[model samples]
Target: MLAVALAAQFMALLDAFIVNVAAPTIQSELHASGAGLQLVIAGYTITYAVLLITGARLGDRLGHRRVYLFGLAVFTVASLACGLARGTGELIAFRLLQGAGSAVLIPQVLSLIQRNFAGEARVKALGAYSAVLATGAAAGQVLGGVLVSADLLGTGWRPVFLVNVPVGVVLLALAFRVLPRDDAAALAAGRARGLDLPGLVLLGAAVSLFTVPLVLGQQEGWPLWSWLSLAAAVLFFTLFCAYESRLARRGGAPLIAPRLLRSPGMGLAVFRVAAVMAVNAGFLFVVTLHVQGGLGYSALRAGLTFAPSAVVFGAVGLTWRRWPQPLQRALIPGGFALAAVATAAVGLLLRDGGDGGLWLYAALVGVGAGLSLGFGPTLTRALATVRAEDAADASGLLATVTQLGQLTGVACFGALFLHRLESAGAPGAYSSSDALLVCAYALASVAALGAVSGLVRLRR
Candidate 1:
C-alpha cells in the first residue's frame, strides 16, 4: 500500500518537470507560440491549484480509496491522451484535465499514510515517502531529457507522458486489492456536507482570470486585454473570498472553512510553505531552461547535471525530523541563501566565460534545496494541531497555495530571464553571463524575502 501511494506521488512530481525538457521540442513540432508553450505548463498548474481544495473535499466526502481509484483512472487515461496528442491545443487541454486528476490523487496520499501507520512505523513510512517524492521531482528533469534524447519507438517527447500510463495502471490494480475499505458511517456523514458548487465555480473563475493574463501577456505582446484580465483576476478573487465567507457564516458547506484562515500558526505556516514552494518550483523551471535552452546543452546532459541536487536533497530530507526545531526553521531560509549564492556564482562563471563549473553550483543549490524543503514535516506538524475535520481543509488549502506559488514563481522568473535576454539584443546577445546575473539577482531578492518571513514568524 505504501509503495503504491509513493508511486502515485512520484508520478505527479515527475509529471511536473518531465514536460519542461521537452518544451523546445514541443514548441517546434506543434508550431506553438511562446504563450502556447507556457500554457503547456500553466494550464495544468492552474487547474491543479484551483481544484485541489475541492478534490480533497471530495476525497473526504467519498471514501479516500474510492476517490483515489477514480483519480487514478482519469490520470492514467489522460497520460495516454497526452502522449497521443498531435497538436499544441490538444496537449494543453488534456494537460488541464491531467492536473485535475492529479489533484484528486494527492491529498488522499497523506491522509492514507496518517491513517495507516502509527508511531515509528508511520515516521519511517512518511520519511521514505518524502524522500521518494523529492527524488522523483529532481529525477524528472533528467528522466525527461533521457527519454527525449532516446526518442525510443519514435515517440520523441511524448513518451514522457506516455510512460505514466503503464505505471498508473499498475498502481490502480494494486490500489483496488490493497486499499482498506472505508468506514460506512464516516463516509456517510462526510458526504452529508455536500459539494461546494458555488465555491468551485468561483475559485475556477478566479484561477482562469489570474492565469490568462500571465500566460497570454508574453506571447500576445502585453495588449490592453491582458491588463484587463489582470484586473478581472483581482476582482474575481475578491468576490470569491467574500462569497465564501458569507457561505461559511450562513452555515453552508464552504470549500475552505473561513475559520481556518483565522488560525494564527496554521495561517503563517501555510504562507511560509507557499513562499518556499514558489521559490523551489521557480528555481527548478529557470535553471532547467537556462541549462537546456540558454546554454544549449543536450537534454540528457542538462538532466544529468541536476543529479547532485537530487541525491543530497533526498538524504537531507530523510533526516529532517532529527534536527532541532531551531535548525528545522532555519533550513528553508538558509537553503534559499545558499541557492542565491550558487545562482550568483553561476553568473560569475558565465561572466568569466568559464565552463564545467555548473556541477559545483548545482551541488550548492541542491544541498540547500534538500535541507530547506525538508521542513515539510514541520509545516505538516503545525497544521496537524488544527481539528481533525479541519485537517483536510487546511491541507487542501496549503496544497492550493503551494501550487499557486509555484505557477507565479515559474512565470515571474521565466519572464524576467526572457525579458533580460530581449533587452540585451543580438550579436553580443544576452550572454549566459547576463542571463545568470539576472537569475541571481531575482533569486537573491526572493531569498531575502523568504529569510525575513521565516525570521518574523519565529519571533512571533
Candidate 2:
C-alpha cells in the first residue's frame, strides 16, 4: 500500500519538474509558441488543482483503493496518450487526462495514511513521505533531461511520460494484491450523508473561471472575455461559500466544513502552504528556463544542476520531526529567507552574464528550495491534527491550493517579469538579465511573505 502511494506521488512529482527540462525540446519539435508550451505544463496543473476536492470525495464515496487503482489505470493510459501525441493540442489534452488521474491518486494516499496511522507512527511516516516527495521533485528535473537527451528509442522528450507505463502497471498489480478492502458498512453509512452537489458545482465553476482566464489572458492579450471570467469567478466563489454555510446549518455535508476554516492555526497553515507552493513552483519554472535557455546549458546539465538541492532537502526533511517546537516553527520562514537570498544572488549572477561564480549561486538556490520544500510533510501533520474522517478533505484542499499556488506563482510572477522584460526592450528569448532580475525580486518578495506568515503563527 505504501509502495503504491509512493509510486503515485513520485509520478506526480516527476511530471512537475520533468516538463521543465523538456520544454525547449517540446517547443522546438512541435513548433509551439511560448503560450503553447505553458499550456502543456500549466494546463495539467490547472485541471489537477481544480478537481482535487472532487477527487477526494470520490475516494470517500467509493473505496479509496478503488479510486487509487482507477487513477493509476487512467494515468497509465494518459501517459501513453501523451507519449504518442504528435502536436501541442494532442499533448495538452493527454496531459489534462493525466492530471485528473493524479488528482484522484494523490488524495487517497494521504487519506490512507491519515486513516491508518496515529501518534508517533503517523508523524514518522509523514516525515518519510515528505523526504521522498522532496527527492522525487528534484530528481524529476534531472531524469527528464537524461531521458530527453538520451532520445531512448528515438522518442525524444516523449519518454518522460512514456516511462510511467511500466511502473504504473507494476503498481496496479501490487495494489490489487496488497491494498485492504474498504469497510462496506462504513462506506454505505457514509454514503447516506448527502454529497455537496451544489458546493461542488460552485467550487469547480469558481476555480475554472478564476484560473482559465488569468492563464489564457496573458497569452491571448487580456481580452474582454477574460475580464468577464474574472468577475464571474469572484461572484461564484462568494455564492459557493454562502451555499456551503447554509448546508452546514441544515445538518448536511458540506465539501469542507465551515468549522475547519475557522481554526486559526489551520487557516494560517493553508495560507502558508499556498505561499510556499507559489514560491517553489514559480522558482522552478523560472530557474529551469534560465539555466537551459539563459545559461546555454544542455537539458542533461540543467537537470543535474538541481541535484544538490534535492539532497539537502531530502536530508532536512528526514530530521525535521526531531526539531524542537520553536525550531519547527522557524524552519519554514528560515527556508524562505534562504531562498530569497539565493534568488537575489542568482539575479546578480545573471546580470553579470553568468560570470563571477554563478554556478555557486545556482547551487545556493537549490539548497534554499530543498530546505523550504522539505518541511511540507511536517507542516501538514501539524495542521488539522491529522484526523481520520477529515483526512481526505484536508489533503485534497491542501493539494488544490498547492497546485493553484504554483500556477499563480507562474501566472502572476511570470506575467509580471515578462511584461517588464517586454517594456524594457529585453530580447524575446530566455537569456536576458532583465527577466532574471525581475524573477529574483519576485521570489524575494514571496520569501518575505512566507517569513511574515510564519512569524505571525509563532507569535499567536
Candidate 3:
C-alpha cells in the first residue's frame, strides 16, 4: 500500500517539473508566446491548488481508496491527451485536467499514511514521503531532459507526457491488489453529509480570478480586464472566507474547518511552506530558461546542469535522520542561506553574458542541498500539531498552499524574467543578473525569516 501510494505521488510531482525542462521546446515547436508557455506550466498548478482542499474533503467523505483509483484513472487519461495535443490551447486545457487529477490523488496519499501508520512508524513514513517528493522533483528534470533529448521515434517533447501512461497502469493494478478495502460504513456516513458545492464554486472562482490575470497580463500587455480580474479576485476570496465562517458557526462542515486555522503552528507552517516552495519553483524555472533559452544549451545539457543538485538533495535526505536536534532545526535557515548564496553566485557568473562554468554548477548543488534541508523540515513542523481526525483537511490545505506557492513563483518570476528579457531587446537572451538577483534577494529575506522563527520556537 505504501509503495503504491508513493508511486502515484512520484508521478504527480514528476509532471510538475518535467514540463519545465521541456518548456522552451514546447514554445518553439507550438509557436507559443511567453505567456502561453507560462500558462502551460502555471495552469496545471493553479487548478491543482484550487481543488486540493475540496478533493481532500471528497476523499474523507468517499473512500480514500476509491477516490485514489478514480483520480489515477483521470490523470492517466489526461496524460494521454497532453501527449496527443495538437496546439498550445489544447495542451493547456489538458494540463488543467491533469491538475484536477493530481489534486484528487495527492491528499489521499498523506491521509493514507496517517491511517495506516502509528507513532514512530508514522514519522518514518512521513519522512519517506517527503524524500519521495524531493526525489520526484529532482528526477523530473533529469528524466524530462533524457526523454526530450532522446527523441525516441522522433516524438520529441511529447514523450515526457506519454511516459506517465504505462507507469499509471502498473500502479493502478498494484493499488487494487495491495490497498486496504474502503470501510463501507464510513463511505455511507461521508455520503450522508454531501458536498459543499457553493463553497467549492466560490473557492474556484477566487483562485481563477487571481491567477488568470497574472499569467495572461504580461503577454497581453496588461489590459483593463487584467486589472479588473485582480480586483475581482480579492472580492471573491473575501466572500468565500466570510461564507465559510458563517457555515462553520451554524453546526455544519465547512469546506475548510475553521477549527483547523486555530490549531497551533498551522498558520506559521502555511507561510513557511509557501515561501520556501515559491523560491524553489522560481529558481528552477528561471535557471531552466537561462540555460536552455539564453545560453543556447540543448535540453539534455540543461537537464545535466541540475544533476549535481539532485544528488546533493538525495544525500541530505539520506543523512538527515542522523543529525542532532539543534542542527536539524538549524537546517531550515541554513538551507535557505545556501539557496540565497547559490542564486547570487549564479547571477554573478551569468553577468555580462559570461559562460556559467563549473563554479555555477557548484552553486546549483548548494541550492539542491538547501532545498532538501528546508522543505521536509518545514513540512514536518507544520503538521506536527494536526490531530488525526483532521489529517485529511490539514494535508489538503498544506498541499494546496504548496502548489499555490509554486504557481505564484512561476507567475511572478516568469513575468519578471520575460519583462527583463523584452526590455533588453534580445530575443532568447536571459538576464540572470537582473531577474535572478532579485530572486536571490527575496530568498535571502525568507532565510532570515526562517532563522528568526527557529529561534522563537526554541525559546518556547
Q: Estimate each model's TM-score.
A: 0.89, 0.91, 0.91
User: Residue-wise lDDT of candidate 3 within 1-460, one digit each (tens)?
Assistant: 8889988988998998898778878998899988778889877777777788788988989889989998998899999999999999999999999989999999999988877788766766777777776666668888998998898998878999999999999999999889888777767766665677888889889878877776667668889998899899899999999999998888777777777888766776687777767777777777777767777878788877778877787677656767887787677778767766776777777766666677887887887777777777776666666676677778788887877777677667767776777676756444544555565566556655654554546323
List candidate 3 segments past 4 Å from native.
23-42, 86-90, 184-189, 192-194, 425-434, 458-460
Q: lDDT tens digits, residues 138-191, model 1?
A: 688889989999999777888999999989999999999998887687677678
lDDT of 2 by residue, 86-161 (tens): 9999999999998888888888887777776677777766766766655665688889989989998777789999
lDDT for residue 121 in candidate 3, whole number 0-100? 68
Could you tell which candidate, 1 or 3, scores higher by lDDT? 3
Please name the candidate that would achieve the greatest lDDT relative to the true structure: 3
Scored by Cα lDDT, where does model 2 land? Answer: 0.75
Residue pairs that clash (backbone atoms under 3 angstroms), model 3: none
Per-residue lDDT of 236 in model 3:
94
In model 2, residue pairs whose N, Cα or C atoms come closer than 3 Å (at least 3 residues apart or on different chains), thus clashing, are: none
The stretch of ten residues in a row with the least summed lDDT in candidate 1 is 366-375
